[model samples]
Target: MAEVKLFGAWGSPYCCRIEVALKLKGVEYEFIDEDVHNKKSPSLLKYNPVHKKVPVLVHNGKPICESLVILEYIDETWEEGPSLLPKDPYERAMVRFWTKFLDEKCMPAMRKACLSRGEEQERAKEESTELLKFLEGTVSGKKFFGGDNIGMVDIVANFISYWFIIGQELVGLQVLTKEKFPKLGEWMDEYLNTIIIKENLPPKDKLTAMFQARFEAAATATATAAAAGGGGGGGGAPK
Candidate 1:
């Protein structure tokens, strides 16, 4: 077996994707947790100079960056457990298509709702809800994206298992509803219910606290900016 090592931030679902893949494959490796926000380590920079982000997988002394790419690498490298991807070329293509859609299309709206406020947040909430319905279409008639078992799509969509809660809470809006998206909502339950997935997930309370911190900081910055703008606009007038 090739020596494997993972460098990642515990709270990041992207990191968790690769982690779950390795576990499901029954691969053994070392794990290193980076101080995601406050400290930037030299090793993180050296391994992923371009992105300098978490979830970099090092296989046999070579580093693989990007969550999806690393997922494919691990799947292809190990031949145990269920395949991360489908063997059928058409199904594989479909899996890849939806995964890309989640990253490129769904993620942006989700991020906008999570990080932005006011009109932008509301707009993102609307976009996110529609995008989620589209995602539900992808689920179709399967227990998971890989049909009976969890696969690449399940790993890639791992964010929805947990982070979706934080996003909705942050924006104070409802996008994913059981009535509107029964399939996808059930998929979320199935994904989380999977044993390895449930065990490996970051603590929900910590994740929520982290997001709440972001919201509070953004609010403070907006308030400070408004105060500065008001003071600057009014100070030139003589009493």
Candidate 2:
């Protein structure tokens, strides 16, 4: 049996993070696709009892949950190749800080945009725009988040490369357009063009279609709730 195994879903950007890290580290692992939305496998539950989430990396029967944590574990375990964290303590701290920012602030905004409509959608768009602007400013003259080479923070923040673009298409928003956020847009191109990142990303049209279906399903659920008179006690119809 393979010493390392990864439980993941195809459409999950979280899963993609671990995949990229493992590939970058040149670790050979078994890939298990878990149906995150529907039913999870027994192994997934056994591995990650707390979150029961995908992207669980099981090494020698011990499981590591959370994509970021798994990346750190991989980095520490496999000391070969380019380092994910910076050598300097301050630079490493900055990387962690930005990665946390992307996870907490940027991801939430993007999720909101995915599941929202009307005023709520507008608010999400605004928030996403602000987050993108902040990221753009941070990258002002830097080649990558880790300065010269890609690091853990860059790998973690890479969801903005393909997933965010898919989110824009699915949610029918243009928050990260070239005109609105040119620097960020350029940065996205640069990131995606990188050898490791480019090779690991999912197919564009396929991801777009998957997200579109999810968006429509969420909208349908909202409409169904409104029809059943169980929607947040609103006077007007769903936008």
Candidate 3:
């Protein structure tokens, strides 16, 4: 068997995507935890010089970075698991389209809401819900965006299943609810409750605390920057 090792962070949804892929494939891998806050590992830099981020998969001494790219790689290399992408080329393209939308639109908006305040948070929440609504329309009847079973779309949107909800709670907003967005709300519930997904999620309480800390840190950094700006000579010279 080719040696497989994963470089990941505890709270990273990106890392979880790779982990879920490996688990579903029944492939055993050594996990390396990256401390992204204080100091990133040299190997992470060496492996993924562009991003220098977590969820870098080193397989048989070669490194693969980017969660979505890593997922494609895993599916292609290991034939044991269910296919991540759909069979029909058009369906595969659609899956890729939705996956890209999640990464580019919905996820980033939710993230902004989680880490911002007041008007900015409201704007982010609004933007997030709007994109989510678009997604709901796109994958309306599908149990998972990838279909009846979990697939690439499901894996990429996994953040919506747990972290997005947790982030909403931590930030005190409710953009994704059953009443307003029935399809997305139901999909989140079903996607999350699936056996492999449920077992592999970051604990809710722990994720809450992590986001709480991040929110505070962002607040502090913003406040400090504001204070420095106010005190600096950028304004007209004081009398």
Per-candidate TM-scores read 0.91, 0.91, 0.91
1-239, model 1: which lDDT tens digit per residue? 68889999888888999889999999999999998677978888899999888888998989999998998888888888879998889988888898898888887777777666677668877899988878788787889977899999989998876787665765576777677889988898898999999999988788877777776666666566678883211111000
Off by over 4 Å in 2: 230-239
Q: All candidates: CA RMSD in angstroms?
A: 6.5, 3.7, 5.8
**lDDT over C-alpha atoms for residue 31 of model 2:** 90
Cα-based lDDT at residue 207, candidate 1 = 80
Candidate 3 lDDT, tens digit per residue, 62-116? Answer: 9999999999999988888788887798988888888898888877777887777
Clashing pairs in 2: none
- Clash counts for the predictions, in order: 0, 0, 0
lDDT of 2 at 225: 80
Q: Which stretches of candidate 1 lie over 4 Å from their true place?
A: 225-239
TM-score, candidate number 1: 0.91
Best by lDDT: 3
lDDT of each model, Cα atoms only? 0.81, 0.79, 0.82
Model 2 lDDT tens row, 52-160 = 8888999998999988788888888988777888778898788778888999899888777767777877888888988888888887787776676778877887778
